[model samples]
Target: MTPLIQRILLATDGSAYAARAEGYALFLASTWGAGLDVLSVLEFPPGMNPAYPINDVYLGQLRKEADRHLGRLADRASQIGLSVRKQVEIGIPSEKIIAVAREHGDDLVVVGTHGRTGLEHVLLGSTAERVIRGAPCPVLAVRGIKAEAVESAAASVPLAVRRMLVPIDFSDCSLDALEYAVQVAKQLDAAVTILYIMEPVAYGLDFTLSHPSELEAKRARLGDRLRDLTAAVTGCGLQADEVLRGGLPADSILDYAHSQAVDLIVMGTHGRRGISHLVNGSVTEAVLRRADCPVLTVRSPKFAPDHRRVIRKPEPAASSG
Candidate 1:
């Protein structure tokens, strides 16, 4: 199978959240043998004029601090024997992150969220939300855990994203996300769970699905599709499963992810050519902000496959005995 990530860009500040993101960046780089680019953006003061002479000293000090954070990331990557490049920039945080991604052709961009749910941060216009919305490559928004948990999770050597959850609505973009998730699973040796939530009917007609025959028919069809997807994942020789639930899409996704101990949540950023709007009312962003683990949002495949790499064939003959 072809690897999905070759170059990763990590955006950080000196916060605990960024530190967790750095751990993920290093883990992915080591797993994929990818190069890492660590970036820190020192935002210009809002009302201060750059022409003021005293501001130069202030800006210089901030630059040094940003570089300090970037340096830590570089040292961590080096300890893993991964190639890394570091940079410090002065600009808007999200804009600088997107610019670095475009300039460096990063396959993935990793950023961090600052709260328990991370939604409040996004609603208040946090850099993480903007980066997730505007980044040119797939963005992984990792929410901050408690300090002790953060230290334990980040300090685990040879970190692994052991189980991944992908919530799909069957749109083309969503299916693409599944493909991307499968590629990631192949690389990380992770288990994949494909979840489909059959939302309750609209207009407050909650009991409409209570009709036995009608609900049964729809469930049958959705089951078939979900099982087909599950088969595809298992065919890749990776551990895989399918889940069917009924609730609001975002709620169901978050609930299952938390209960299943998912290490990552992979999703599509948008929906079928403007019909539904990314899983009905920005569900991707909702889950992206609230998910416990890092959420990977993909609009399409992020990396070019290496053609020289040989494919792995299924080992069906072992079962013949």
Candidate 2:
């Protein structure tokens, strides 16, 4: 499993979405004992030329304004009893936010998306999507109102993360995600369900050949992986369960999560491959598109490796020449 989140970066722009991101970040900080770093970028006003030198008076005034904006976040965070550090940056919004995340060695980046649609999204891609594609660590996209308000308004909430769903393909990246999920579950006194999808079964295979026993064997293998994952956090004290489904990976994951009312989904994006890498793949892209719950995606390096896993690059089946 991946390491617990110790440092988190919240990219804010004074938008309601940014505030929402801040709220989620604060909640996570409280849950994991993580440090919150809030950032806001300073952009030149419209029609202003970067090459032109501006008056010192205007520069001072602008910096003061930016400071006030960021100060509000700190104040709110403090009031909520969440420890926070904030900064005001001057550069492109997405770039500056990414650079700050890189500098801080943050394990998670939380950002709110305004849910842009149609031509607007086509013309100006989402900052949240950009960061997700480029970030070195996991990114949580919080939607709707800031989750803090939701949590506060609903006190006596008995369901404090009881079930976590993690979709794995026996890959190192997926194992890393599983580890991360286990750590979170431990903190919340929750249980986890490790899910694996048998892709070929999606096509309705019914073969009683020499490999008739392979299906059961594969199920047993998945069971072993689940055991090993939970073993790492057994002492930390969290119940772990396993589920194996046969069908499309994304569909299976989504159906299971909804059916089980999973609190969260911890997944790993293996840095996309080939030309398709230019865009998010079908499975991940699909999950992110319609998932009602929060989705945590881990990139490379921070992801843990599974010792019992072996990934042999698929060999193209021979053509009937």
Candidate 3:
């Protein structure tokens, strides 16, 4: 069978977190015998003196430094018997990364996130987050790891996607994630666990007695759906299971990952932005920030115009005034 991922793009900034991402990219590229591209974006320095005559010279120096860094990363990949193409561009990191990934039609874009939260994350937005939101294909965001840990792990053996978790919300994106997870599981001989989280329903005091029966019915219905989904995965020759939890989606996902010692998380992102994103937030993003394992986020192709036209329902027109 043909490999699911043919090419991988790894974005780095010469940071420790980027190094960890590089490790995963190398492991996957070698495992799949896929082509690899290493990219580094050189952001123009902020607060530089625009009036200074030597500004251009400083920019040249920065470019040279970035090239050298990328070259060294390429050398490391070569030492591991993996050929890689190195690229350096000057622009906003996130925008440049997305543009390159789109231009090359990469199957997957891999990058590292610092996992910052609250004021820190707000003030210093994550490049990984932006890339995941806008990339044309799936993205794998690796959390930051210590240098010592990375070194030790690299010396020992290549990483494996042994146990994967997929959180589903019955959306097209979630289904796409599940499909990708199953494909990966098939390739790696891994087990997959599909998790569905339902919010607790609040009922009026008058309906208190009947709520228990209603809840039981809902659970039974969900169980049926879960069984169907698991059956489809098992048909693909994979070991699969399903979990139903009641709580906040992100919290439930994280708790399950920790309790199960999951190695990887494959989830879907709605790619919401601006006001809508602010209001609804994103469970995937929350899990990306807090989860201990790597998160592979698949943007639903159903959102594309071509796919949308197939599945979208017609809207009612307004009456003429």
Candidate 4:
């Protein structure tokens, strides 16, 4: 049987945000019974202080710091009875992160929004963003959790994946993500919420000019499709529901996720071979950047062995409402 996630690689730079991501990666590794590789890259020579300079001694110190971070993560993984390994690399953070993930055949790469080198501090030119753009597998970009929020709850209790959100546009890439999310929900006993934006321009007229009957008919067809898909998931013994809204897709997604307190947002992306969705202002990229919770981006199955992933397309985007 194809496991949902056989291997997980976590890229950390020992920042507080990275620590938060480590907790999540460790939790997921334990839950999925997957091997965890905790990787830390020493992006020295630039972020290093002028006093430290670029000498062998400073390089050694950087390696030691990276090891210190990996050691902490590996210890936690071991305590949880997880199979964990540690990796320390020397290079640019994003390049090394993608290279390590590719070398290890990691099914998922977890990263904090900001790295030790502050590559992810700015969303556009950040290390985490670059990794998301080029990683070989699914990328989980996690932002730092509020300390007050963690403290108010029983923070020691492991984080849960109770609610998952998947935004679909009836595209192949989106279906690939839905399949991945379904497997995860089944494994973790999480409920899923599928979001579909209702665009009225398909009728060749603006929303204001569309006839009420046209609008009603459009809703009926989309609702049927949504129900069919949601039922397909529930048929697998997993709970699922659908939401249909009319507005900008990304804004609607973020609003619903926040109001509903979704734990994870799973969206689809075309492979790295194409022009990046980032340049095209993709809804998936927008949600990834602004979602209140963690966002998991999955590409199509071209990169791996397929397990009968025959995704039924509702219709083509140009024609589908």
Model 2 lDDT tens row, 1-321: 444677889877665435545666777877877888988777545466545556445656767876887888788678767788888876666677788889999888987654222221221256666777788778886554443555563354432457778887766677666766766676777888877887654223564343658778977877776666656555456677677778767778899889889877778776223333455454665576556667777664353453232222235679996
Q: For model 4, what is the error of residue 59's alpha carbon versus the real structure, in angstroms, after optimal superposition?
A: 2.1
Q: Write the per-residue lDDT of candidate 1 for residues 212-237, one digit (tens) a residue.
A: 78789989999988888888789868
TM-score of each: 0.85, 0.72, 0.83, 0.85
Per-candidate clashes, comma-separated = 0, 1, 0, 1
Candidate 2: regions farther than 4 A off: 1-3, 42-48, 51-69, 115-125, 145-160, 202-213, 231-236, 271-282, 301-321
Which 10 successive residues of model 4 have the least lDDT summed? Answer: 271-280
Candidate rank order under lDDT? 1, 4, 3, 2
User: What ranking emerges by TM-score with the best candidate at the front?
Assistant: 1, 4, 3, 2
- Evaluate model 1: give its TM-score: 0.85
Enumerate residue pairs that collide in model 4.
119-127
Which ranges in model 3 have alpha carbons more than 4 Å from their true place? 45-53, 115-124, 147-150, 203-210, 271-280, 300-321
| lDDT for 90 (candidate 4) | 75
- Cα lDDT of model 4 by residue, 100-187, tens digit: 9889989899998854444443466688778888998889888765444544443576689999999887777888888888888887
**Count of clashes in candidate 1:** 0
Per-residue C-alpha lDDT of model 3 across residues 180-263, encoded as one tens digit per residue: 777778778899999998765655577654467888998999998888889888876789999999987778899999999998
Better of 3 and 4 by TM-score: 4
Candidate 2: 10-residue stretch with minimal lDDT: 115-124
Evaluation by TM-score, superior candidate among 1 and 2: 1
The C-alpha stretches of model 4 lying farther than 4 A from their native spots are 44-53, 117-121, 146-156, 199-208, 271-280, 300-306, 314-321
